[model samples]
Target: MSDEPLRIVHCFRSPVGGIFRHVRDLAEAQTSAGHLVGIVCDSSTGGVHEDRLFEAIAPFLALGVTRTPMQRHIGFGDLAAARRTLGILHRMKADVLHGHGAKGGVYARLFGTSMRLGGRRVARLYSPHGGSLHYDPRTMTGRMFFALERMMERFGDGVLFVSDHERRTFINKIGEPRGRTTLVYNGLRDEEFVPVEAMQDAADFLYIGMMRDLKGPDLFIDALADTSRTTRLPVSAAMVGAGDDLPRYREQVRLLGLSDHVRFFDPMPARDAFRLARHVVVPSRAEAMPYIVLEALAATKPMIASMVGGIPEIFDEWRHGLVRPTVEQIAQKMREALDDPIQFAGLMPPAESLRARFSAGVMATAIERTYREALRRHS
Candidate 1:
């Protein structure tokens, strides 16, 4: 491998949620380390909130940001999208094609392989980010995706997993990866470690993330209702983030008569959302080391999160405190936290511990080393 800076291009589908966060962190960190980085993602997904995020990182993207229409599922449209993506990658002259999710992984490996055929020495890397791994292997959709994952392994030089559970799920569902694999936990920045103080009129709880079922926004609402009824007291919350199911969640809150207590807001910075509530609740049904958990912990904000995916790994010794993603369980935990805030706060991992384990600097270094290794092997 050359000592010169590597030109890296990250390809992902949605420029929202954790995948986007991961890419932004990597792009900034990599750029600081003297590497040139770029981003390629779907243009049709994010709104003003995501636009703001892109603007913050645009200056660091040496290869620049490229967006195009990308369909969420397999279709004839993929052929056109893939061609466009391949063209973009070729033009960027990326030394490493790093894909962030299922769709991105497919594009990175396939497009990177196509480039290789034309005598390009690009290292193809894929990070699942709990994308297709969320499917059930027993179902037809799951089997099909797993099969594709197994096949795609051959086209990539390496697989990067954000959590151990993500890697295990891939092996259990699709069998052992044919290429090299690395487990790199998602990380947080130094400024993110600064605790966010609640406003004088902050809500009782905060649910920040996509307003979709998988993330358990519905469960959070039901738990809030359950908590209020059981305690015979009003419980207020702020739900942030945008999703297709936003209307459904709003309807759910109204139907449950929580319209007065629950407020919906547009997607904003996590720290900004954190200050709107005294406590955070992550009731995700599944995850791959969600950045929200790390962010909340680093911010020194007390929180209760479901034990799923790589969350257990994040919790580590504190994993015993995690609850299952259920209305009853989430409600019970909510009540517990509210009833005895001190005891609940004690369950949180120390900020110093989180900072030591999950930092943007560490994450970027490990990933850069992995890229170099892949390039060396391919060379």
Candidate 2:
């Protein structure tokens, strides 16, 4: 241990999505700061996307790619994969195990707890990234998630919530001890996010993210459809990012005869995708801190998003952009946003200020401090 750099392992079920992006950013930051970083994730099957994620980070550090044979569904395969992950942890001799999301968090906690019981000094950190806690408490799954949180709380040395709202929700629902939880806003390298000059001629609203049910891609289409009916403005919408629901969403667009008005593009590098749009929309049913919103804010693009999760914390009603409750509300906000030049201008200063707060340097420093603290605690 004395001769080695801090051996850090980031465990995630898949090396994709916003959580994966966060992990990549941290790994690069840690490597630059002179720490050894490694990642373990599921193997890529043919036709499986997210290969770009591995490609993006491989050149930066010593990455250990372990492919877990696990189906995403809740069954025997997942348990077998968890066992495989535990074996990997034992082999890696990781000093700190940082887990992202539900499956990763559970596996890391169990592994760390077992190691601690055996007199091994391994610290554990869990970043939920808005998993079970993101659901409304009225449902059965939400209740089960609450119970799971209680079960897992004892195993974690520290819990990091991406937003204050997420932390507050966790405290409110689970009654977990507040002292162990910390709020670490997701950060991105602002240098990578080149700002697009507000396009005076760009015609469509842009939505970039997986086209999953919770992301509300359909709602964006529906809102665009309604907006077209009410206004004479030739509004068009472009969606980038493919998912299991992409074909079904394509059918919905065709059934609405909106093939021309609504277009779907293959997911491109985030910077390239952001350059092609005028306004960004995040209509997710739930989120913790979406990197898309941070990227949009960093790009200084005006946005309209759902008033859920950490979104309201990111943007005030009349400050950065509008945050609405429903699709119709989002459409109403869009119409209002288009009509009000003064309000849009008012948003720029605050947006720019917000962008600086999430810069990579700031985030790296915060995370480094957290890592040091965790190490000190273990010592």
Candidate 3:
């Protein structure tokens, strides 16, 4: 493998959420390491916040940022989108085409293969990022997606999983990958390790993430209501984030008579949201090494999360303390957190252990090594 700088292009569907954060971290690290980096993602999704994030990283993206319309679900429109995306990528002449999520995976592997016919060397890599794998294999939708995953396995030089749980899901649903695979945990930056102090008037708890049901925003609301009802404690929360289901969650809050206690706010920085509340709650139904959990732990904030997806892996030995993704369980945990804040704080994983295993620099170095190996193998 050549030690010279290489062109790296990261392709993904949405310019929001964990996958976006992961790409941003990798892009920054790779650019700092003297490689040309670029991003191609859907234009329709993010708002001003995401635009600001793009602006911050725009200066370092040597290959430039490109965006176009991309539908979340598979449709006939994909043909045109794929053609346009392929043209953009081919023009970049990327040495490594790394895709995140399901649609991006298909585009990277299939389009990267097409680019190979043009007589240039290109390493195609795909990271599932808990995309289509979230679907159940027992359902027709799940069966179709898994079948697609099985078919696409042969096109890529490598498949990268963010967690062992994600890897296990792939094997169980689609069988073993025909191509190379590696597990790389999502990571945090050095500055993120500095603890965030709660504001003087912080609420009892914080619910920060997408407002969708899948992320359990409703569960957070229900848990708060239950905690207030069961304990008669003056429980309050700050719900931060935006999604299609945001209004629905607001209505649920109103109907449950939580309008006075639960205040909804637009999405903001996690650390900023952390300041709005004394404790953090990640009530996700599914995940693939969520960055929020790492950020919360690194900032020395006490948190309770659902025991689903790769969360247990993050918790490690503390995994036994994770609550199931249910209102009853979440409410119980919330009550415990409210009752003894110090005890809840004690459940946090040690900072040193998290830094060693989940640093952005380490993640970038390992991924860079994978890129080199994939390039050599493809060559």
Candidate 4:
């Protein structure tokens, strides 16, 4: 193997949420190491903010960004999507095709196989990121998706799981991966570790994530109401995000008569949203090493998050702050945080511990090692 810089392309459907954040961080780190990185994702996913993010990361991507209509479901559309993605990868001569989530995984693995058939070598990798893993195996759709997942494993050069729990889910649901896989944790930058001072009139709590039900935005609203009623305190919250389910959540807040108590904002930087509230709540119904958890913890902000996916992994020894993704549990936790901010803050692990475990530098180094190993095998 040579020490020359590698050309990398990340294929994923939507350029939003945690996956987008993960790719951006990885691209920056890889670029700093003199690697050529690029992104291929859905163009229809985001608004102005996403366009800005694309521009910010454009400097690192030698292949530039390739945006096409990559849908969320399995349909005839996938054939065309795969072709577009494959064409882009061939053009980039990508040494590594790293796919994020389900659609991205399908595109990357299939495209890698196509390249191999055309006498080109590429290391194909998939990171589940709680995509298809959220499906119930007993359902027909789940069965079909899992079966497809099994078929795709053959096309993969390897898998890059974000957490051990995700790897376990793959084993339990889709059977053991036929080849190789590794657990690579998501991470954050150095500046994020500093303590954040809440705005003078910040809300009592913050909900910063996609405004979808899977993320438990409704649960956040319900918990806020329950926390208000139980503690008899005028609890206030700021929920920041955008999604298809946003209108429904907005209606819910209005129906609950909390239009004022629960303020809403378009999706912004997590740090900015963190400043609008004293504490952050990640009420995700499911996940695979959510970046929000790492972001909030890195900001030295006290948080109450669901004990699902790799969230508990982040807590590690500090389990007091983790809770079930439900209204009652979150409401109770909210009551505690509201009752005594100082006490709740004391429950979180120290900033130094989190910084050591989840830094972007460590994450990038491990991933680059994985890429090198996969390339060797591909060669």
Candidate 5:
């Protein structure tokens, strides 16, 4: 191998959600670190917002990007896309193949093994940023996904988990070798949080993320209904992000007579949404170190979140913010936060410190170290 900068190929299903942001940040950081970075993604299907967003971000980095007509869902198209990916990898001569999300992981393993078998020195790494493993095994789809994951282990050289809880849950579910996995937490750039002048008349609570069921948008509205019955503090809530469930959530808000108390905004740039409120609420049924939580912490905003996934790892006690298990508990915590502004202000410094530990720079260094280790093993 030459002493030239390591060439990396990053693969992801759709350039959306936390996975997209993570891959983008890593690619920018690697480019800055003097490495050659390239990205491979499914081509744009006209009118898809996520595809357009990906197209926008692709050209900003000092790397090449190749998009094939791959579908996210399993289909005949994906098989052809996999072959295209193999052809791209061969041409790029990538030293490392890094995959993000479920479809990306599948492609990386399938084609990466072919490269390895052909006596190419390419290494494979998969990052499952909280994929189907979060699904409860009581469902048939979840069980099948677990089995598929177990089968994929034979092809992957390393797996990067975004949270300790997720790593533990995955290891227990798939029985993968412990040595093959590493915990690489999701991180935020400092510019991700913009300070808003302490709004004297802003909304009392805010929720950011896709307006989907797993994100608990409906439960948040239900909690607001519960809070209004107990207190007449004139509380207001902001729900941000766009999803397939937006219409249903709007209907629920109207049914609960929360039309005046709750307002919905289409997803804006994240910093703009974070700066619009003082309190951030994460009522997700499941998560794996959501960037919104880290963003809230970076902005020194108080938070009330469900104690799920990697949330507990971010804050120890109520001093930083509150963590609970149910919608009722989330409402109680919000009420408490509204009552004690001084106590909430006391959480800022500690929260900032916690946020710094997971900055984008730290995440990039961890990933680069992993890439080097993978290369060494293959050598």
Candidate 6:
């Protein structure tokens, strides 16, 4: 390890979703290891919950935070935004610029490239947490994004993938990256490994991710209705997250006449939310090793998750834990969990194994090593 702590800056688009969680864990780990860290992300995306998270993590961000109006798509206006982002990064003089999602990755690699050209010492690293990989390459939009991904790779010093599935998808969609690539699964803190028993009035099901289509919140609501009908029992669900599409999902619940059965809340700490329901439901259509999976597993909470992204990888040989993303498939699992959550819970990996494989300490050390490698090659 170097004598001094490295200055690290993380850039991403929305301050929500899996990307945001991943950065929070990584930032805490890095800070505890005596590193200086900062965050640069979109100001308008997250809400009051995220504001509290920023407050809790403020001490770690010695280089300070930069929240700007960042757009989702690449457009003429992005040129100005890029300049603004570059200005923030330049002022920080970050030793490593690590980007979390597509927009953040683009900014990090491009800005780091400019810093290198100016004889500045910096390393550019990217972790694609299934941001751009959800695109269907057969479509025109996919082609455009994949092409942009290829160009972005040229600017990257080291490419990090959260799962083997994400890495394979990147190679298939964007071609083999010329830069170094590494696989680092998401991790959890030791305290998270303890089992979490539900509260006395825990809901029958819980959906605790971003309230958006990509995460399949709509499917969760549909399956809850289906489960109630099939089982002939009134089932309740707690949807504990916030996103731009939350209003739309609320309308969906209203139209489906599930207002009484399904209750909504803004985002809260994952551990606290875990106690609100008997079983967690992660019905995402796409993912790249979601931290929620790791969190739930570490907490020894029984779960029903969709078989997308790196979720299957988490189960390892116990792939029976996965269900399809469709309403029918999720409903099937929901019924089973309702009937016998104890048996269903047996399918989860042991806490010891999960703790061994997905420790935050291990993840931070491995990522810091990658940063050092990138800095060494920063010519």
Put down candidate 2 lDDT per residue, 1-379, tens digits, no spaces. Answer: 4434677888877666688789888888878877777887767431334676666667775646566764554577777788888889888877788888887888888998887777788878888898777667888878887888788888888888888888877888777653477677888775855676645555557888887878888888877777777776767777888778999999988887788777788877676776666777888888888888877776767788887788776664444465554778778766766677457645743555676667766776676666667767877
Q: Which ten residues in a row have the lowest lDDT in candidate 3?
A: 313-322
For residues 185-285, write the lDDT of model 4, one tens digit per residue. Answer: 99889999878879999999999988788899999999998988888878999999999999999899899888889889998888888899999999999
Q: Which candidate is the best by lDDT?
A: 1
Model 5, residue 288: what's the lDDT? 80
How close to the true structure is residue 57 of candidate 5, measured as C-alpha lDDT? 67
Query: What lDDT tens digits, residue by residue, belong to model 6 across residues 1-379?
Result: 4657999999999998788888999998998888999999998788898898888888667887789989998899898889899999899999999998899999999999898898888999999889888899999999999998998888888899999999999999999888899888888888888888899999988999987799999999999988888888889999999878999999988988889888898789899999999989999999889889889888888888999889988888776568989999989988988888889899888888887788888889999999998887754
Ten-residue stretch with the least lDDT total in model 2: 44-53
Tens digit of lDDT per residue, candidate 5, span 1-379?
Answer: 4446888999887665677778888888888788888898876532365656656766755458887877856778877788888898788878888988888898888788888888888879998888877767778877888888888888888999888988887877767553478888877776754454436666888888888888888878888887877887667898887877899999999998889878898766566676667788889888887877777777777778778888777675544465555778877877788889678767644645666668888998898888888888879
Q: How far is candidate 3 from the true structure (C-alpha RMSD, Å)?
A: 0.9
Q: How accurate is candidate 4 locally (lDDT)?
A: 0.89
Give the per-residue lDDT of model 1 (tens digit) for 185-269: 8889899989889899999999999988999999999999999999999999999999999999999999999999999999999
Better of 3 and 4 by lDDT: 3
lDDT of each: 0.92, 0.75, 0.91, 0.89, 0.78, 0.89
Lowest-scoring 10 consecutive residues by lDDT in candidate 5?
A: 44-53
- Model 4 TM-score (2 dp): 0.98
The list of candidate 3 runs beyond 4 A from truth reads none
Prediction 6 global C-alpha lDDT:
0.89
lDDT: which is higher, 5 or 6?
6
lDDT of 2: 0.75
Clash counts for all predictions: 0, 0, 0, 0, 0, 0
| The 10-residue segment with the lowest total lDDT in model 4 | 80-89
All candidates: CA RMSD in angstroms? 0.9, 2.6, 0.9, 1.0, 2.6, 1.3
